[model samples]
Target: MTSKPVIIVTGADLAPEALALLGDYEVAFAGRTPQAADLVALARKHNPVGMIVRYGSVTAEVMDAAPALKVISKHGTGTDTIDKAAAQARGITVTAAAGANAAAVAEHALALMLACAKSVVKLDARMHAGHWDKATHKSLELNGLTVGLIGLGAIGRRFARMCDAIGMRVIGFDPFAADLPDYIEAVPLDKIWEASDVISLQCPLTADNKEMVNAATLARCKPGVILINTARGGLIDEAALFQAVQSGRVAAAGLDSFAREPMSAPHIFQRQPGFVLSPHIGGVTSAAYVNMGVAAATNTVAVLNSVREPAVGQQ
Candidate 1:
């Protein structure tokens, strides 16, 4: 009997379709929300040639444990969780199922923006309590609003299209992007900070850009700016956000991710009326889950078999 090839599943949740894609591979799952040590243990036990990694930190230790590991496939677009330096040093190929979940994340961003503008959450609570809020909670129109994007990558470009369809002017800041699509004006970072009515974060978190939405940056934003973040939680300093929102400098904020996951209790922004929080479901749509899973699995298989992987979107 032929020994099945082994593959390790990291922090990101997997759909059955992904497993089906790897027909003969022996799959070993590192439980959801695994730490670096857990990944190392799993790699040592499985001795995998490839890994379908999600959000866990893939450190040098984890790579050392898997001497045969040839590839690491990211289930989503972001590769921040993986230590690319170590992986590259070990001659391991890293691929991402980029843009596989862009639509779902873009939709979530739009939902948050609209909910904030329409006071949807606030009104829903009042209605459930048998109270009418016709007079106090006024809503804003998005038709003529200008929405700024921090990054014009796959997800940001997708969100820009949605904003255009809704008659909202779109301007964005992305140092690497050139010749943007119609209706999106590429602007400097300072322009976005000063001129935008609403700002959304779609960029990856880097050492240079970490907590870019802190106090100094927030001070430049137009008064009553609405903020939305479907990206990393570390992108925004929650303390600064809490203070800004509390002071009404930022009228509302929609956050899908936070600095810490499975968020702690009694967070300052927990009960704030102007903030809408989601448990990082930006890319978890039913359709996206399958797409990302299959893509990641395929990428893993391709690299292991020395086949060229399909063209992936922005990562």
Candidate 2:
């Protein structure tokens, strides 16, 4: 029997199609919600040549445990959980399944915006309580409103197109993006805060922009501006967001991600009606799951293959 190399999947399972791609390799699971220590243990046991990160952080210690590890592929777009500096130092490649979950996340962002603008969840709760709020309730109309997007990558751009089709004027700020469609007007962060009726985040988390939507930035937003975050949770300071919503500085906020994952019970936001929360399910659709899994697997295989095989001219 041939001894196949190992690949660790830091989750329960991958799509059947994705798994089929790795028939020649042995796959090890680290379970859902794995911690850094769990990953280190698995790496040490499997001596994996690659890893597919679905949950938890991949620290330098985990890398050190897997002496043969050559690549780390993210199951989703965000790779903030991975220690990029350590990976680079050890010459281990890191990759993300970029654009695989773009449509799902973009649609979720739009859903949150509409839910906030229409007071969907609040009205439902009122109805469930046998109270009729139709007489006193007023919902904001989204047509002709300006929406400011923080990132204009694949997900952001997909969301922009949706807003445009809804008759919204789309303005965005992304210093790294260019050659955008005519429908999207490139603008500065100041303009995004000052002019937007709805502000949505679809960017990655980075050191320089941690808690970018803090009290100071929220203070600059237009009164009654609706906030939607389908991106990283750390992008917004939860405490500041709670206070803003409490003061009605922000009329409503729809959050799919939080600074802390698997948000603890009795969270402060749970008590606030102005805040609509989803447990980071923005990119968890059936289609996106398969897409992301396949993409991650493909990236892992490509990286491993490059290292396992020699150049064309080599003997």
Candidate 3:
């Protein structure tokens, strides 16, 4: 019998269609939230050539256990959970399914903005209570408002176009992009906070960028500004954000990612008013799942076959 190159999938099961695309590869499944010890054991035992990780940290210790592992394919866009420097030093290729969920994330951010602006949650609660409170007039109109986007990458650019189509004045901040759409004025990061009625975070979280949007940055934003973050949770300090919302400095916040997962008991943001929370489902839509899964699988196969360089990281 021919021994197929082994691949381990960490996290939930891949969609049936995504699995079907893998053809005859020998694939193993692991829990979505596997412990470090479990990961180390699995890697040592399976010695898979590739791994598709979602939401689990691929630490150096885990990597060390997997001597035969050649590639790490992140099931989603963010690679913050993985130890990139370690992987690079070991000459193991690391790739993420970047741009695969751009549209889904952009749509989620837009939905958050609308929900916050109109107080959708609160209004729904009031209606359910049988209170005739039609006199409440705390909603803000999104039309003609200034929407500031941080990091004009694939997701950011898509959001900018969507906001522009909705009659919003779109302004962007991306240090790397040389040019932007005519409708999106390329502004300094500070100016984006100052002029924006709504600020949507689309940047990746890195060591230098953790807690990038803290109390100091939040202080620069326009009063009553709406905040939407479908990106990494560590990008904003949850404590500082809670204080800002409590003090009325921030009107509302929509969060798809948080500092912790499952958001079980004792989650900080659960009790906050004017807050909309999603279970990190910004990029988990049906379409997004298929796109990202296919991308990761195809990328994994390519790396295994030595067909091309991995599509993520600097060499």
- Per-residue lDDT tens digits for candidate 1, residues 86-170, read 9999999999998999999999999999999998998899899999978776799999889999999889999999999999999
Off by over 4 Å in 1: 11-13, 307-315
Q: Whole-model lDDT for model 2 versus the true structure?
A: 0.94
lDDT per residue (tens digit) for residues 1-315 in model 2: 228999999999999889999987999988988988899888888899999999999999999999999999999999999999999999999999999999999999999999999999989988999999878999999999999999999999999999999999999999999999999999988999999999999999999889999999999999999999999999998899899999999999999999989888889999778988999999999999999999999999999989979888895
lDDT of 3 by residue, 150-210 (tens): 8898899998999999899999888888778799899998898799999999999888879
Candidate order (lDDT): 2, 1, 3
**Residue 62 lDDT in candidate 2:** 98
Please provide TM-scores, in order, for all candidate models, with all chains considered together: 0.93, 0.98, 0.94
The best candidate by TM-score is 2
Whole-model lDDT values for every prediction: 0.90, 0.94, 0.87
Error of 1 at 34 (Å): 1.9
- Ten contiguous residues minimizing lDDT sum, candidate 1: 306-315
